[model samples]
Target: MASRAGLPVATAHRLTGELVSWGALQRSGQDYLIGHRIWQLGLLAPAHQGFAELAAPYMQDVLFVTQNVVNLFILDNDQVLLLERMSGTRVGAPIPARR
Candidate 1:
């Protein structure tokens, strides 16, 4: 981790310990994974709420017309995060997004 971050080993270890103590990282074996606190904080961003609200009506319209499942997602940290899902019995298979 220190080498990857371009920091001294001791400094990296110290920073990792502080982050773990602060609920920002969880030590998993020899690796660190982002903690639940980080996810909670990310979800609290205003953009999430604003985007959900802005997309809600369009999402509803599509759902009403097709009666298919709808997923509201945002790209974050190179991953897609599902923010909302509306579904009925007629849901279809997933479609991959294009770049």
Candidate 2:
């Protein structure tokens, strides 16, 4: 990790320990993975803000017309991320859904 990051071994170890203490990284067996705090922070960044709200209406419309699953995906870098899914209608839908 130090070589990859171009930082000294001791510096990398100190930074890694601090990040783990701050809930930014977690150890699983022998490997470390991103923790919940990092994921929450990513959601607060500008690129992810309000995307679910802005797409909710369209997702609901698709669900209303097709009565099927509606998934909203965003292409981030090379990964396709599922931002939202509309699978069920409100408790009191105006019209009955098809069988």
Candidate 3:
């Protein structure tokens, strides 16, 4: 995305460092990804994960009644981290474990 945005490599690197310092980004090997601290902070925000956790039981009840899937998502910045995701499913998703 930075490349697409025409961001200079040096500027991108410096920006990434700032984000990491703020706990908004995590650095792994040579790449950057969402930091766990962000998730920890989300748990503290009343309007976000805090409320979601509180209402989860009710939401689960409704999903059970309707036989539907329940999904929860947390938003984060756009940075790919060096990590591996292993699953039974096979797809062409990019794997950054080699970073």
Best by lDDT: 1
Give the per-residue lDDT digits (tens) of candidate 2, residues 1-99. Answer: 899999999999999889889999997887888887998888778765489888888888888786667888999799887777778555345555579
Q: Cα lDDT of model 2 overall?
A: 0.81
Clashes of each: 0, 0, 0
Consecutive 10-residue window with the lowest summed lDDT within model 1: 89-98
Better of 1 and 2 by TM-score: 2
- Of the two candidates 2 and 3, the one with more favorable lDDT, higher being better, is 2
Q: How displaced is residue 14 in candidate 1, in Å? A: 1.9
Q: Relative to the unseen true structure, what is the C-alpha lDDT of residue 1 in candidate 1, on a scale of 0 to 100? A: 91
Deviation (Å) of 1 in candidate 3: 4.8
Among all windows of 10 consecutive residues in model 3, the one with the lowest summed lDDT is 81-90
Best of the candidates, TM-score: 2
TM-score of each: 0.66, 0.66, 0.41
lDDT of each residue in 1-99, candidate 1, tens digit only: 999999999999999999999999999998899888898898889988888999999999988767778899888788888888888557674444548
> Can you tell me which runs of candidate 2 are displaced by over 4 Å?
66-69, 89-99
Better of 2 and 3 by TM-score: 2
